[model samples]
Target: MSDVAAYPVTLPAFVPEHAPPFPGQPPAIARAPRSDTLRCSTCSMRAICMPQGLTPDELKRMEALICPSRTIRQGETIYRANDSFQSIYAVRVGSFKTVVMHRDGREQVTGFHLTGDSLGLDGVSSGHHSCDAVALEDSKVCIIPFHLLETMCREVKVVQQHLHRMMGSEIVRESSQMMLLGTMSAEQRVATFLLNLSDRLRLRGYSPAEFHLRMTREEIGSYLGIKLETVSRMLSKFQRDGLVDTHGKDIRILDHESLVRV
Candidate 1:
């Protein structure tokens, strides 16, 4: 059975509501990678998810802080709004969508996360999660207890910087989405979304020109602040214009420059 099928939807009990205070300064990282440590050290997404320039000893120490990975099936939630934030997760496989519910019970998809992306940062400031992270498919995530991570950050300047960069990236992404919703045309918004996904996939060593959409048209519309029909219409226009070819959820960008022009 797949890991998702093997595990239940319920999240296992995690760290306490109040984590212990940060410990004293630790020694610097070592120089070589270790074969026996946690999967984070040998993970293919290590470069994207972890800080660079760590020695073997430092890498080992970082790996020690990670709890075993968790798996969830499609549509299952990894975390819910208002839950106490004890840890952050790195998407180790598949995709997820973070959504927030309006006061009237409408669901708004705030963002989509793919492999190597980080989740649960929204809770960092308030100590409670602000949105729900639901699996887009059968997925796995590496759990990094936040308090332990903070302790490591205090001892390692590089780790601290990387954490800041990750947080900054999230802010920039949200800003861009706001701009897209407020100013961009329907076609432009759709094109930009596809291009953004393509670029991110390329960075992760996946094919840039073609991939399957993990989220539905309705979900895409929600994230882009457009109607579901508008998303479908814009995609049809792109395909008709020979900029892209779509089959069901599959998308292939045929003319990158043309799509950019749109």
Candidate 2:
């Protein structure tokens, strides 16, 4: 652990935002829409996930480029490292965890994607995915074929800028993770993780104070660059101090400001 004290870190809550499940309720299963009826213009998540200020004609063209939603079963990978990158997916119905395998065969959890978030951008650089995107539950994703998307970008300035912004968000996310691992203590890392998750859920229109964590403690530890025991200890300490309430996988933030100060 670093000797550096915990500081307030503002993390990026990136990408096509999902309409959250009802506050304090479990996420609902997302069903795949029929190909003919699928349109980005009609999606509930378009306001947050799509570009702002596009003309009607451009919107129609953009809608034409998106394929019908595809369902990814729980624990199944949507894509894996070295897989040919043909399209990027926007999470529409469920959550996912992206991971990368180390040379030693240990898998490191990298990012957790909720509904309305984008995936598969990792493949844009080399034309192959660099990690595995596995669904945390039965999930649905809107497939945007990248080559067609490139063509759309050439035709639509807003779409091109939006793509650039999405790529930039990925860069910022990676930089934030590096900062977390390099500068924070184990306790701080855990606290920051909870705070960040809370913010993201709130943005998605879910309950900011309480929600069910989809990832296991080990997976959370992997993402935070801490041991499982340390992560457990910190959560327990938070509960004891009335900073949070926990029941198995459920977490309620009781003291948001204190967590930020942690």
Candidate 3:
């Protein structure tokens, strides 16, 4: 592994006045939401995940179907490929990357999941998970029992509709990634990836313009369908062109609009 400390990152302080507050935005603190409850009833991410718009009574009922959040250390597998799928997980802290291995032993990264993201939805169609959910850092996840969730969905229209929407959103995201891989140039792909990550960080109450990248350049290349050297070259070009500042895992986006145009 490369020694990340060898690179020093320059990140600017977040200036909130530059943009109007987004509706339903959480606090501006750059950390994962506080986990004060074992269930969705009191979660800080309730506005983003399943509990959004749910009634107090409904949240209480949801507690029954959820197991106490479980912690997964870095490099730990939340669920291995082909494991029987029982529950979908809601990321409560930290991030994770999902990967799939083929018969010949080659592995491809599927997705990077952050707080409020759902994992294991792919297993709903089949009985087993197709990808491995591995923690990118020390993480905690709320295990939502699928069987009980299904029962609730039948009784609650919101539950059923929300679950369908979540699944549909995942499908749409995958389709967008397919487009990114098959169509965009390496520089454009990197730009799009940065924009997407920035947007996600913004929603999670982190600084959109400055943040640490948890994934390595090789991992980013694998996910973006580019070579590692190409990724490195484009990043250097971006820095030289005044688009971003990078140091090891840390990045500071200098021109969001210029990147969008690339």
Candidate 4:
């Protein structure tokens, strides 16, 4: 496991801004909605997954093969490096970071998984996780047992295509990260990270330009390959330029385009 200091990170408790009153209402329902049902019916992420092309029977079969898990609190470790990889985890809500420690004990964040994202796919062959996955906020995941999923994929053409697309996306993200690390300035890095987070939140049906940050500035710096002070300074500069509004831990993007152009 990485020797990265475990710091407390909290997700803003998600309170639906437009939740309607009464059970079985038009807007927000009383019981938390099932992610699988949502994914099957309403998720914009279907384009990247094979679920969209599956028949009703196939969808039902797939849904039955997976089990939705509870929310993992911020700062909690979902899985540690070298642990047995029993199931593939899909982020139904919230975000998670995967990290690996170098020989000298320095930590490198491998990637951040957002809603509709999956982790532990890389460990399929090895049966042991390669990195540590930590929740960045109160998050929920659907655990799909590898054996069941694999069997279904073999039987369903759409499932195979979906898995292939997901892997391709992961590769592209890694490549983008490498390029960003190699070419971007500290200011650019910070701006890019914020923009990415904003975009991700928007995809999850939240306010894109205005939302609370889940990770601390230090963690943001670590992920972006910069110092904590640099992250603070850049954010302050953005605030001064009217690119964003920051009140303690809360950040609201006043001018998203300006921040992106930085």
Clashes of each: 7, 2, 0, 0
Estimated TM-score per prediction? 0.86, 0.85, 0.84, 0.78
Give one digit per residue, the lDDT tens place, for model 2 in 55-131: 99888777666766766778777777887777788887778999999999998999988777898899898988898
Query: Quick one: best TM-score, which candidate?
Result: 1
TM-score of 3: 0.84
Poorest stretch of ten by lDDT in candidate 2: 1-10
Q: Which stretches of candidate 2 lie over 4 Å from their true place?
A: 1-38
Give the local distance difference test score of model 2. Answer: 0.76
Q: What are the Cα lDDT values of the candidates?
A: 0.78, 0.76, 0.74, 0.68
Residues 1-262 of candidate 3: C-alpha lDDT, one tens digit per residue: 0000000011132211111113454222222333434556567676667735667777677776676666667777777677677777788888888898878997688888888788878889898888887788988777676887899999888888878878887878888988888888999999988998998888878899999998888888888888889999999999999999999889999999999999
* RMSD after CA superposition, every candidate: 9.6, 9.8, 13.1, 10.8
Model 4 TM-score on a 0 to 1 scale: 0.78
214 in model 2: Cα distance from truth in Å?
Answer: 1.0
lDDT of 3: 0.74
lDDT of 4 by residue, 89-201 (tens): 77767778888888999877777777777887767768787887878887876666677778988999878777776667667777778777899998898888888878766
Better of 2 and 4 by lDDT: 2
